[model samples]
Target: MAGFDDITKKAQSFLQDGKVQDALKSEKAEDVSDKVFDGVADAVKKVTGGKYDDKIDKARDEADKRIGNE
Candidate 1:
């Protein structure tokens, strides 16, 4: 239910949190990133009345694919 920026901040904090990163190590990075960011994008789209939906969604996808695949 949080906004896109909030989600992004949370994700950044998650990466810096040792325990969370450790837990994430057991999962597929690409799958996890995609799932998480995709949800963030959806939430953002819902709140913004679709004004920036395409751009936000596209950025989310690119970030997910690029970062996850790396």
Candidate 2:
């Protein structure tokens, strides 16, 4: 789970980008966020050989919810 934390932290940092925040408030917020999160998770999957794919995806999904709620 340590790997999960590490990746999620990185993902969170990515989420902090101004572009991401802007994207979250766009007309297509859900679609944009989903694409971005899926892209990030896909990259993590490749880098970690899918070992942490589940964790990455789970974190991305939860983050998506938070973004949507906000």
TM per candidate comes to 0.54, 0.57
Name the regions of candidate 2 deviating beyond 4 angstroms: 1-27
CA shift of 66, model 1, Å: 2.9
| List of clashing residue pairs for candidate 2 | none
Off by over 4 Å in 1: 1-27
lDDT of 1 by residue, 1-70 (tens): 4698899998898788987655555447767877789899999999999999879978986776554444
Scanning candidate 1 in windows of ten residues, the lowest lDDT window is 61-70
All models: lDDT? 0.77, 0.82
lDDT of 2 at 15: 90
lDDT of 2 by residue, 34-56 (tens): 78888988988999998987799
